[model samples]
Target: MVRRRLVGAVRSVFNDTARGERPVQPSDEALFAPDTPIRLVHADVTAMMVGGVAALLMQALHPRALQGVLDHSNFREDMLGRLRRTARFIAVTTYAHRDEAEAAIARVDAIHARVTGTMPDGSRYAAQEPGTLAWVHIAESWCFMEAHLRYVRPDMSPADQDRYFAQSGLVARKLGADPVPDTRSEALALIARYRPDLRGSPDARETARIVLAGTSRKPAERALHRLLGEAAVDLLPGFARKMLGLRRPLLTSLPTRAATGMLANTMRWAFGR
Candidate 1:
């Protein structure tokens, strides 16, 4: 019965992403095959959720990015709707047929075209801009891999990491993020390079609160939501932690790890094998 409920919860998280999307089915041979690095890297549902939230928080560290989200997104009224859209895009582009992936990218690109406006200082920000897109892309890929390393597979080889970074660039480039990094070191350098431009603001904090405030109708699922939220905070970069004022006590490490493992294993079991 526990497994049955877990199966439903996990399915809702991913399958529902396609709710309002134009259907995109995977080919017999999807973009990433079963044993490919991309498949191996992103197959864990729990790690993806934990890392995805961490990435969202990290992305908002950029003032312009946060401003763009605040100014344009309907996050207040429909946070889960936003998350489902994002998840759908990722799912279609990564796992679906090439035509489906292209369709998803076209839809996203059209949305991004309208995601432009002026910042407080009168500087302009557009989601499609190279720098802005790169930041979002890198933050997402970095956090997802970080979560995979910590919770799903601690022993992920360095070469595999490099390949994952390199291959992920395919999607990033498609999204118009030029000069995406090709290796782990470059990925870290990309983050470091943007430090001067990244900082916490009221927008960032508010977004974090909204992300953490995700509640489930089912009581069993509420614990899982909190676990993912806390794990996201714990896995964030020290600078990110400081920016968001999310400090993790040293004593919480073991407990955090234990909860994360449970979440990961539970999802894996529910999904099978």
Candidate 2:
């Protein structure tokens, strides 16, 4: 009965929005918006959550997944090749902001150096050197979007989303990278240029659809319940309560020590800690 009601509510919300009516404001909206410093912080939090969950799941199921995904033997060479290709794309599109673009490229170089503890083989990595300024302008802009979208309103009108994407592509091209692709792979590839070592087999086009869908329609609370069913609740009652508190905070609280223990228990349940 509860699930049915929740589904009905979600459908009603979407129907209203689709018909140009104002949907009910979620209680959390005031706390989460596109243009706040808190949004950036939230994005960072979400990234950490995604990374941590991925690591935990992979470790539990197959410890070798990491090694297989990041096969070190050809990793550097492959990454350098991709970077060079990306640099060419940036050169043509980001010409107007050449200096800023090159700085973005340098940032990627620095990230590479930190990751590998050595510079990529210059001879192996060499492509026609594009203007440094252009490279920075492109790479940094891409980084900004990657970091920004995770926390900000990932849902915008289709027209606005397209405009924002185009502006990002322009930044990339000005830095000497090729024109950005309208497809999901193109966006993922752009990100890969900076962090080639990170590998996930997520389909770019599917991801784009998910992002758009997530933004376009009202999110179904039933989906949340499905993800956190009775098994999840029984496993860590305290943490489960806190999650519930997110929707009804006035009804839940714990002593500091108990809250700490609940969090620890939740992580342990999640990671076998």
Candidate 3:
């Protein structure tokens, strides 16, 4: 009963009951093959939680991306809902059947088609821009891999890591990301190339605060969320932390990692992973 409740609680956080989202079952016809690195990296709920936050921080540093979110998304009022939708999209694209995955991609593409606006500097931005989409994709995929390595599998093989990028790039390409990297070196190089375009605007800082502030109300859950948020910040690169106005205190890093590792183990146990 305890295990069931734990699993149900996690599902509740990731799935929107009003929209009738249940747990996504793995299918034989999923986009990637079984036992692939993408599946393993994306399967860890706890690590993904940490990585997702870090990814958002990195993505927000892109002015066009930040402007797009500020203009089109109700993220300020519905942070949890936005996160839930993103988690659902990742789950669907990673584990659901190819047809389902393609449909999800189509839905996002349709939304991107409509997400266009002007930035504060009189620069226009569109969600469908290849370079912008590429930044978003690389930020997210790299952060997810970093979290998995830190919290779940520190000794993840280089070849497998490259494969993970290659597999994930398939989805990115479908979503119109240009110059998608299929290996670790390429991913790092791509990020370096895009670094000049990233900025820590005031709006970006506020969005980062909202993301780290979390949306939980229960005291225990809130405390856990805080710990996860700290770990997520710690997982970010020093440059990114500086860009997002996040500091990684030398004092809490170790304790936060230990606590988050414990939570990851607990979650793996609950899900029979």
Provide the TM-score for each candidate, comma-separated: 0.93, 0.25, 0.98
RMSD of each: 2.1, 19.7, 0.8
Minimum summed lDDT over a 10-residue window in model 2 is located at 54-63
Candidate achieving higher TM-score, 1 or 3: 3
Q: Report lDDT (Cα) of residue 95, candidate 2.
A: 34
Q: Which ranking of candidates, highest lDDT first?
A: 3, 1, 2
- The ten-residue window of minimal lDDT in model 1 covers 17-26
lDDT of 1 at 181: 90
Backbone collision count in every prediction? 0, 36, 0
Question: What are the lDDT scores of the predictions, listed in order?
Answer: 0.82, 0.33, 0.93
- Strongest candidate by lDDT: 3
Model 1 segments beyond 4 Å from truth? 1-4, 17-28, 215-218
CA deviation > 4 Å runs, candidate 3: none
lDDT of 2 by residue, 173-273 (tens): 53344545443345446434533222233322222122212222235533422222221222222322232221222233233223423433443344322
What tens-digit string does per-residue lDDT give for candidate 3 at 1-273?
999999999999998888888999999899988899999999999999999988999999999988899999998889889988899999999999999999999999999999999977797889999999999999999999999999999999999999999999999999999989999899999999999999988888888899999877899988977998899899998998998889999998999999999999999999998
| Pairs in steric clash, model 1 | none
Encode model 1's per-residue lDDT on 1-273: one tens digit a residue: 888887765566656545553434545566665566777777788888888889999998988777778889987787777777777777777778777788878888888899999999998989889888999999999998999999988998999999888878898898899769989899999999998988788778878888887845677667777778889998899999898878788998779889889868877888685
